[model samples]
Target: MSKYLPLSERLARETGDQWRPTLAEIEAVLGFPLPKAAQQAAWWGGASDKPHHRAWLDHGWRARDLDRAAGTVTFHRDPTAGQPPPPAEAPPVIEAHRGVGGMALIGAGVAVIAGVGLLAARLMKGRKA
Candidate 1:
């Protein structure tokens, strides 16, 4: 087995879409310190032939971001790599007549009806007088 197999297993166990592993964290996972060449960004790049690259790629992860200064690499899960696509966001439910607005509309309708009824009552009273 490849020496990087431990790293692959660790990444495979992660359920998040992205992982930011520091160089030290990666070293711990691999059970050894990274080589001097690992300081370079190209060393963390995607090269299917590279054992280290294959360690993550084979598990549906890709090195998308690297921070050489911070000594960190960010791996993103490959959606098309036999992994289920993220659930699509459901459309928002819009109720034109709901909540306080609906209540206000009903209250206004009642007020208008009551006002008309009072006006009719006054007219009838005047006729009776």
Candidate 2:
């Protein structure tokens, strides 16, 4: 439902590996004027998450070489397109405390609580004496 869907279709139809469409040309395809942000080179970067970027990226194109002065953006066919991404390595396993160490920690905590209780009882008894 992106407004730039037409641009996606247009780029999909392009036979060349590279396309340098003018801002005006892109706007024409979108049936609207480009936003003020589009004047910046960063706006045409290869950020696939962006709607405009997705227009090209979904069609196996990646925007680069933005010429703001000339009001043009060069989109090259993504070489990695249709290829599977490299497999991510499994994360390192962290061993949890599973023996006496863990039990000792719990035991120490209980001993501290018991010691505090005994101290409180002794203080109370001395006050009552």
Candidate 3:
């Protein structure tokens, strides 16, 4: 899609708070014309859950000083939120039962080895007798 989501994200990261690049500057970052929705100012707002907004919001940016008549928009980064933390998920739980299973496998191997040794010793005794 021509949402320019990736391009918007790059611009937000590349520009500092004082830096306000014009539409042309943004297009240079994009390397192409603004996307269908990107061309409109309303699409630049962060309040909406529009897919394009996430491209900037995820990177700590929100639209500001947008001059539609002049074809310019400035992106301001969130100082407090320099980076958004990853979404919350269940923490990995480690259990003490793991080592018990491994020990069981080791014990089985030792038993087999002992049984084989006993059988070999019995065979040797029978052969000698």
For each candidate in the order shown, give its overall lDDT on alpha carbons: 0.86, 0.85, 0.71
Tell me the lDDT of model 3 at 80. Answer: 38
**Ranked candidates (lDDT, high to low):** 1, 2, 3
RMSD of each: 14.6, 3.7, 10.3
Model 2: per-residue lDDT, tens digit, 13-83?
99999999898999899999999998887888745578888788777887888887888989899867434
The clash count for each model shown is: 0, 0, 0
What TM-score should be assigned to candidate 2? Answer: 0.73
Candidate 2 residue pairs that clash: none
Selected candidate, larger TM-score, 1 vs 2 = 2
Cα deviation at 31, candidate 3, in Å, is: 2.4
Off by over 4 Å in 2: 82-87, 96-118
What is the alpha-carbon lDDT for the whole of candidate 2?
0.85
Q: For this target, which candidate reaches the highest TM-score against the unseen true structure?
A: 2
What ranges in model 1 sit over 4 Å off? 80-129
